[model samples]
Target: MARPDSQLLPLGDFKPSDEWQTHVNAIFYGIKGPEIHHHFQTYVSRDYRLAHALADTFLEEVRKQRLADDTITIQEWGVGNGNLAARFLSRLKSVDAAVYSHIHYTLCDYSEEILNGVRVNPNLQEHEGRYFLKQVNAETQDDFEPHSVHKIISNEIWDDLATSVLLQNNGMLYEEFLQPLLQRNIPNVPWESFVEQFAGKDLDALKKNPPFLEQIVWERSFQRIDISDWPYGTFILKHLDRLADEIPIPINTGAFQTLERAKQLLAENNLGYTSFDYGMLSDHELNLPGRPYYKLYGGQYTSMVNFPLIAEVGKAIGFADVQLEHQHDFVGRNLSENVLSALELVQVHPRISRMEPWDADLLMLQTLQALNASYRSPYKGQMDYPPMPGTPKKQRKQITELARNLSATGVPDTVAYITESEVAESTGRLKKLGYGERDLKNAFDRSTQPIAFGHMTLR
Candidate 1:
């Protein structure tokens, strides 16, 4: 098969195929519904330290505050699959069963499907009497009661929140671009005509909107791909311009105004919240040189990191304290080294072969640099592998032999790979983005294994 084009594809015809939609829906709702769970799980498991540390810290904070008691209520704004919530509950149960015995959980998400999935977890079945799952949009007030929640947690949810402006831009441009295509009803429209009519117009419109335009130009540019019948390419180019036009400008009065409103809501309720995701220079972290999270997926430069604008609004709204806690501590020390090492030595080696139904599937993902440096595959390889017949014994024997060899040499496969020119290219990209040798070393050290984060709670 032809290599899957990595370039920016047109959103005009970008309706998710049924299978893709299922994947997206499963993720959006936080349901560990097959494909979606596997997609995120590989990275999370490999980065186990990062996941556990964040969850541990958040739960520890709640524990320290003595909020595990029945009277204290915790609500997760974008509680996906209740993973973090489950972890928090487990920790509380371990510390003092009574404290967790009757604790109330309000799990909220935008998708009803996710909310429903939360309601059905077997682990949660015993505690079903104490939990509530609701569909909520963070921008609106109807879904939650004011000043009622003691702690709010969200993980990896804010970045995807559909802002009115984003939707408006998408809807408007989609309508405009599609009108021509739909009118023609041919397989495609002329590339140049599509660009002139939609792409140029959208950019012009954005330029006119000084605030949003400044945000796009100054903040960051997203990944762009060039397609060459690519009438669809031209159409998508127009769509992207529209999307870029929708990005809210930073350092502007209008931007501040929206932030001010968000702050008002947080203050009005006096709620304590924590958010976990990738971003640089948060509203809480002023004057610090912002770091990019992932160079791929639009996080190329310092500005590409998705700033916690909502959390900023919350602080502005008058919360006592607002901060962006780094996941690096977890990512580096705990995930890359400790937790993953433990799993490798214990669970994976001894139990995997003997077990009939293996507990977990494992897969590897290259870092952004590694991916970019390597030959791009048309198919993004599965991050998780399913159990195959008669393979356990062979796999176990191979693993044992590999381990014995590694023990003698004391060198990892990743270390060997890093010596290559391709790895050098990846390391160079990382260095250019402010990552030091230590960072690269940590990345390389952890590359061979899979990592998992325990949970993420956003408030």
Candidate 2:
């Protein structure tokens, strides 16, 4: 049912989009809490490949810096569901108990609800006294002294940070501002109720009335302004001046601040800050016309992290060097194998996408069965693949059996990282599924796109 247009509720006066973007995202995460995973997946889920890879990379550095009786402090920003921390710590312990003993892990997030959810994780219970949780906003919080921490890490948090969209056209600059409107009326809920609740940061009220969130509508306008007074404004403008006109550029102001704060927290000889996220990697990519700069997921505003700009900011903040590369490359370097993401491997079966939905699911399970032989994960985590509602009894039974027999080490169906040797070992089964050695090798080919999933480090 549509409300009369006149009764629509408008949220907050129009200003820079990030101000409202950050506010709305806070409301989303605060209301949904850890249950936000149902809306999107992180690399930590399905398998522990990324966490293990990260742990392996950090292990070498930890070994080099392990002086007698010194505690190695590591902080993970945006610790969701605590899975990454659990797996990283577990891997570190399994491989080298001595180094793990010197570890003091801290999980930091802005939402108390998220921190509370992480506190009760059964995995964290096993590492009792080794880790603690801190409620700190990545953008502005400076809870630690300068050069106090050893290493800082975050995954997929940058895109959600406050970002403003800017457009350069005909020798002028403009900032995008958004006005969020309720697309329709909710039964017995007045516009005033929403305005009050949103302004008050009333998570309880917003959680109870979920429908209001589903109806959010954004109206956009651009205002020309001088950004000389804004934080890092001059640096951002200089970067933007090099890009093509009429293309919107995402200025990751929040991400820049995170780097600044990370510089302060990291020790002089620290391993420094490492972040894994998806975004633009080069100026050529940002200069392309009609490129998307931001997207909305589950009513939360998210922008690409703008890696090129972020790299420049990291260097400007006095980091010795900045390293930017694809996430697969980073994982591969640590594991000493040519790594390919699960999605990339699935692309080897060209006809899979053209098949019926259920047929595709069956084929996917079959593919996983083949890869399960050699893609064993040291971490034991459950991954289920129940068939669709209308699956035939025989096919359903097959899927059930495959899922049950899924190796405790089976490759994840979505984002699992697999090496070339692991794929080579599964050649017989892969051939049966119409994937040969050549196809498998080609899956690891690096993508040339400007914006893709990547990792970055500041040291």
Which is the leading candidate under TM-score?
2
For 1-459, candidate 2 gives per-residue lDDT tens digits of 654754666777787888888988898788777777656677875557788888988988776866325888899998888988998999999998988898899999999888888888898789998899999999999788788789899998999998989898898999999888874356245667868888788888877674555467888999997888987777888898788888888988889889989988988769989999988888878887777788787777789878988988788888878999888877788788898766667777767768776677777777777888767666666666678779888888887887788777677545677788888888889888887677777877775655687889889
Q: Number of the top candidate by lDDT?
A: 2
Q: How many backbone clashes does candidate 1 have?
A: 25
lDDT tens per residue, model 1, 55-156: 456456656765555465666666555655654565556655666675677777666655666666555565655677777665344544445666565565
Per-prediction tally of clashes: 25, 0
Worst 10 residues of 1 by lDDT: 174-183
Off by over 4 Å in 1: 1-35, 42-70, 163-271, 282-305, 308-312, 330-459
Q: Scored by Cα lDDT, where does model 2 land?
A: 0.81
The TM-scores of all predictions, comma-separated, are 0.46, 0.89
Provide the overall lDDT of each model, using Cα atoms, as 2-decimal numbers.
0.38, 0.81
